[model samples]
Target chain A: MEVKLASSYGFCFGVKRAIDIAQKYENSATMGPLIHNKNEIDRLQNDYKVGLYRDLNEVKPNDTVIIRTHGIPKQDLKDLRAKDAKVINATCPFVTTPQQIVKKMSQEGYSILIFGDSEHPEVKGVKSYGEDLEDVHVILEKSELDNLNFKHDKIATVAQTTRKKEIYLDIVNSLILKNKEVRVFNTICDATFENQDAARDLSKEVDVMIIIGGKNSSNTKQLHTISLENCSDSYLIENETELDSSWFDNKKLCGITAGASTPDWIIQQVVDKIKKY
Target chain B: MEVKLASSYGFCFGVKRAIDIAQKYENSATMGPLIHNKNEIDRLQNDYKVGLYRDLNEVKPNDTVIIRTHGIPKQDLKDLRAKDAKVINATCPFVTTPQQIVKKMSQEGYSILIFGDSEHPEVKGVKSYGEDLEDVHVILEKSELDNLNFKHDKIATVAQTTRKKEIYLDIVNSLILKNKEVRVFNTICDATFENQDAARDLSKEVDVMIIIGGKNSSNTKQLHTISLENCSDSYLIENETELDSSWFDNKKLCGITAGASTPDWIIQQVVDKIKKY
Candidate 1:
């Protein structure tokens, strides 16, 4: 048996930068959680005085604030600033690309369609930027296509960063067949796409698979969904204790994968447990 | 704005099935076209009829016969009688799953590790049988643990139905700390993982992202990966004339993404067209 490594494993540039920044602003009264990863978030909670105010409503004058990697709603920032709070923007550059699209589409007065979960922080922030325009719709399925009358009027669309890469095209192809004048923006961050690709490539070589990340995190879930379709033996484990003996019984090959939010140390733990097996 | 389509997209289970069996039988002959992506690899080039040859020397009765999803791998009643023919079994279980792992792994005395490329068909195929393994390794970063040099161990590892997912793990924690018996397996199919996730997500929601495919084929570069990702603005056009100018203007939002193996489509078409702005 030959042990091999797929080449696409590492902390994405955005996540790495966010962590470094969070370390610098650890105790800022206005600092939000470091990132979406539970482990990282927990570390920030323990080491830093990150005030989880939820939204701008929770803060007061002179309160120092740290933003998460996802951008905040533009109005919220305005409101916070009016209250004289200090703000540290840690939104990723890849995420900023979508903001440009949202703002441009809104300015053009094209009806907006965002291809992401309505609840996603990135989507919420992008949507906030487009208040100058009247309508913005969040879509998840082909049925959502019916909402458009194919009026041949300009419409602009984009996506959440962590969404699956393939489904995006299926929906777009169908849209073009029905109407012209529909505009689109490929807003998915490059880092997210690379992570998805890397996970797909890595999952193909091992027997029992472990996808390490925060369980509630969307990118991690995306990795889990992609990994499971290819390897049933692949398990998404947020903690090392989740490593079960049954997954390792009498098997020679094993592989591990992680999402964008996954930390290196957690991946290290998964490696040690498999070595013991 | 300029649009770019990703280079990988849209692989079916049937096609991946064919590819997996083809890889294992690469040393010999394939039972049929390894996959359905005609634009990708020509079927005529990769496969041969199972019973056509007998042996490598005389090309007669005992030559190796490979298995394909459309046909049988183990059921060689006609060719088994041939004096010069041997059999190599490979089948994709989206069409079939083998129940033989219990007998095979137990007989071989190998610990099992199964890796699945997140979105490939071959990864799905291998994990179906890896349930009995003690610790399944389905990630790439942790593959170093798979290479334990235990003296008294027999292990068999298997791969997913697709390739490009074999990620080898790094043993940073030092497996020497754990005293455990081990066996390892390497099973990754082919370019399936590389193709599916890389291109599909970005194609949707962009203006005039071109998908290139053979007009006569299905699931080629133009079909699933291309047309599926971006719903509103994706174009599955084989060439440039199909692009509409109205997709862009002096001031507009635009994005581009692509499917896999669409080398026929020119990226300059997008860059030049968007530059009109």
Candidate 2:
């Protein structure tokens, strides 16, 4: 059995930056999680007095606020600032690009639609960028575009940085069919593309595929999702310990791919463990 | 501003499909030009079609022959009864999905990355159904991925139905970085998301965004490329005559967009008319 790895895999710019920033701020938090990782977030809780608040309403004026890579709404920032909260903005640049576009188009009175998960923080941030549109449609399916009755002739379409390109275009194409105007800026991150392409390729040549990353990571999730499409003998795991050897019983060739949030050490560990098998 | 309409815009799904299958059989002219768009493949005409013996040299009894989206690959239906030539297919499931994946994956290597340009007919055709790579990358980056490196794994990436998505992931963030394994599916339907989005939005906004389709009339070229983008003003016109007197003045808000293969209607028409302003 041979082992294969992707050409473009592992921690991306944003994830690398987030991890670094979170580590830097770890000293200040007392009881709150500083990062999204269960292990890392847990470490932060034990180290600092920082507490995660579901909403800012619970936050006092003097408390510190650390924004995640998903990013918070711009308006929320304004309100947070109004209340005199110290903020550590860790918004990924790719995520910020869509917000900028939505903000500009919205200022010009363009109705907005965000192509991504409705609850994603990045999408929420993008929606907040809209000054005029009260709520932006979060399109999920190709059929959803068919159902949309876009009111404005002026509509600006922005994708949450992590959304798939195929789904994004479907909505844009549907809008074109309806004769509604749509300016779409495909803002999905370069990292997500890299991860996906790498995983898809790695999975194909291997008897079994293993996609590693934070389960909550959108890009990681996408990598895992893409891997499943390419190889049935695949598994999505957060770290090496999640390995289930029974699935590999008949498989000799193995391929390994990891998402952006996954640490290099974890991926190496998986590679070593797979080699042992 | 001199509005330069893209040479390949109104590529209907059918045309895109045809082109996809043709490109895959690049070594041989398995069939005629997949799509009828001259401008789309101007390079191919003068660059490659050179051959000595046209017929039998193209394929042998066991050798594979491809049929485009308009057709199928290698040894399809016609030769299936007789072992004349092996079939290689590039049929769009938008032309044949329900039969293949659900059936094939039910027994064999279900994991596959059928590559082709996302918007092209051929790629869209093959990808028309189930268990393909999740979140297909529409492959439109002008640059590369985080770093120009291949992964250490295997990937089952495929191409678009029309054109190929290069396996090259450009190092956009930094050209110099760690090397990784990569499997790339080059799926680029020459007529892609950019034009669709641009045309749709341009048509619905501004004094008027012109539609440049053939007098021969292909609905694909006449596509909406028409969507709303801004509040100032928006309108759509097929040709210069469709332009109303009210649309122009010494000073007016004019935004122009065109479809694929729309020659100006010929670059000349667009230049001459816009020059009048």
Candidate 3:
């Protein structure tokens, strides 16, 4: 029996930087939970005195306000600057790149099409940049493409930074067939692709795979999906306590991976517990 | 043995109209071989003294010049109108619809993408309408779609009226994947689809299929291709004399279909020859 960890797992550069910034400003109130991992957020609150506030109005004068790694809407930045709160911009640079692209292309008269979950914060942030344009649309799935009836022929597209590369390319391929002109900007970050590929590679050789991350985290959910496709015994857990010994009853090999938002301490706990099984 | 004709086959409305207009003006010279059928052109030339002239320079002053069924370029129309020749416009309305759509869309600043053979007269005619515009492209196959790189996002597309509906739709399906915004105008005439569908239906129940049309006819070639896909024993013939009795040996059921330009007499002769076999 053997247990292995993915080559690329745990907190990415952006998430690491965000956590370091939040820890640097101890007792600070983040605009939202600093990251999707509830265990990490509780640790920050109890150990470092960091607090989570869902709304901008919760931050008082002179109180430090840290932005989440997913980034905020452009107007929110302006409104924050107008206040007396100490602002910490923790938006992932990879996510920022798409926001700027949407703003620039929409200004050039190209209609904007975003390939991602419309309800996701990262997608919502990107969509806000193009919301001022007359022909902005968010396509959550390929089936939604059939409902697109646009007067403007010019079109520019961007994907959520955490989206799968193949799904984005598949949508772009379909768009080219229906339109004479198309401009595509690959905005998905390297971290997301690396983590997904590593998890997929590990799952193929393992009998049972454990994915550790917040249930609400988009990238974590994506890793679980990829792992499950390659290995049906894949399970998503936020912590070691959720692990069941029955899952490893006859499993000779086991694989483990964590989402970008997951902390090193939590991953080590999950790995240590899985080894005991 | 059973011999059957497609429920909807023979000269289409556009071809019939062109023939009627050409026959009305005796001793007239057509701009090109008015239609694709060589036998029909020869019959008109010998029986009615109508001549086929490749160049506009061949028509004498005061001589009648009939436009071909596939239509001509916009510049050719201007050059024809500049002379003192009696002009009889015989451009097929179905083909003309795509030409006008291209001209209108291109004039409105939309880049035009045409799906058809670049060298075909109908495509050439449609391409000419948008040649004055900055961006106009002709894609004959789905493979050529990769070469399409455009700065302008607005895209409008039209297909040659005689093109197979499935081929055009397949290209459109592929284009939709690539472009953010697409405007599709299904320019394929009903006659082409009806004929192709009828031929395909007959081919399924028949042991052998005979496709009658000019060797150079686009729609006829499409029908032959469709028939061959369903029945490998399908054969394309220009006239009754080309039919071989050896092909009929062991073939219990035979289906017949003709191109839009093939005259009724040619189809009748081919049917009689096939019956005698």
Candidate 4:
């Protein structure tokens, strides 16, 4: 059996930068899980003493606090600064761009539409930036647009950095059809595109596909969904222990891809474990 | 045969306003044909002494010039004013909105993409408003997007008032897929939507469809195109004289629609002639 890796996968620029920033400040605490990967966060804690605080209330006045890659809401950041905690922002630039666009467009009197999961922290943070929160809408499906009644004829939309581009386009097309003025900002990161495209291309050539990343990672789930379209025997796992030996018994070629939050060390361990099959 | 008319058709607000403005100033000349219909222009000339000029050079000092519904270029308007001609701007507010957006977005360093015919006067005028004319592009088809290399990643797109909404959405979707930031202004008029939607609904119910307006009218052509999709026996004609009696020979019901440039008198003549069949 032969194993192939996707041409582009794992640890995107923002995640890598966030990890580096955390490692530099030993004994510091992150406002949230710095990245989605639990194993990486555990590693940072054990090796560098970088701890994760699930809530802002956990941070002490003198503690060093690192913002997660998904970013915290505007009020949360202001509160953290007001508490006198030393802060290091690790929010991805791609994520920040949409935040700025939402704030600017909202202030300019355009209603904001965010195409992402409403409950996701990234979307919540982005939604908070809108000048008029009442006019801000976060929707995961195009069908949800029907329920929205905007105060303004002008609409500005931004997508989560890790969302599927096809779904974003569908939402945008729907907005254009119904609205008078639509301002669409394609904020999905380049890394997401490259990784997903590579996974799709590799999955078609293999009998089975293995997607590795945090179970909660959006991009990882997106990769798994795309891979399943081309290869039915696709599985998403966080690490080597989740891989089933029987699944690869009849497969001649196996394709592997990892989400942006996945670390290279974890990918190496998965690859090494799969070799024994 | 029973004759039916689309609920919404003919003489949109802009065209009605232009005709009213043209009628107010007798012995005046329009920089271009006031509306697309030749018959309407001829009527204006004979009744109101409103003549037409093919070029700005034809305008004499002190000549009262009425701008067409589809605006002339910014420079042309300036030249007309500089030539001491009293210009009555009858440009549709819908069309003017896109021109203003393009000018503002371009001046703010965004590239302009006009999803319309390059030869269309409205598209040409909109393109001319871009601060850097070199960064403005006019395209009719989605495939044409492949050849365009925008000078700026920030793109502002606007459609011609009469363009099909589906085609404009296609162009916008393609642009969003390839670009980073896209600002889309749905400059398509409500009248176009109403007329097209009515034509589509009527065509589906009738055995034969008749679309009336100037042959060169974009909205008329769009209605004809849409009608042909639902009813194979769709015919486009400028007036009653062009209607074929044979089209009604076997048809139990005929649906009629007219473009924005079409006047009520022409629609009545067509309806009267169709009843004779």
Full-model lDDT for every candidate: 0.55, 0.56, 0.82, 0.89
Instruction: List model 1 lDDT by residue over A1-277, tens digit each.
Output: 2233335554677778877776777566433555766666777667875546665677887777776787777877788789898887778776777777778867876666677887887788888877453477777776787765532255566777455645665565454334323455555656766767776876776676677877787777888788777778778888788988788776677766677777777788778767776
Q: Which portion of correct inter-chain contacts appears in model 3?
A: 0.00
Root-mean-square deviation of each candidate, in angstroms? 25.4, 22.0, 9.1, 5.1
Which TM-score values does chain B get in all models?
Answer: 0.38, 0.39, 0.79, 0.80
The DockQ for candidate 1, computed on C-alphas, is 0.01
Q: What are the clash counts of all predictions, listed in order?
A: 116, 97, 22, 0
Best by TM-score: 4
lDDT of candidate 4 over A9-124, digit per residue (tens): 99888899999999999999999899877788999999999998988899889999999998989999999999999999999887888899999999999999998888888888
lDDT of 4 by residue, B1-277 (tens): 6899999999888888889899999999998888877878999999999999998999999999999998989999999999999989989887888899999999898999887788888888888888999899888888888898899888888887455678878888877877878888877767878998999999999999999988887879999999999999999998899987888887899999998878989999999988988
lDDT of 2 at B28: 46
Off by over 4 Å in 1: A1-6, A9-12, A29-34, A148-152, A161-167, A170-180, A190-197, A214-236, A244-253, A272-277, B1-277
Tell me which of candidates 1 and 3 scores higher on DockQ.
Answer: 3
Cα lDDT, model 1, residue B254: 49
TM-score of chain A of 3: 0.79
Provide the TM-score for each candidate, comma-separated: 0.43, 0.44, 0.54, 0.81
Model 4 chain B weakest 10-residue run by lDDT: B159-168
Q: What tens-digit string does per-residue lDDT give for candidate 3 at B1-277?
A: 5789998787888888999998888989899989877778998898888898889888778989999989999889888888888889899987888888888888777778888888888888888998454478888777887888754566778877455556666666565545544566656567777888899899898989999987888889999999999999999998999998999998888899998778999899998888877
DockQ of each: 0.01, 0.02, 0.05, 0.68
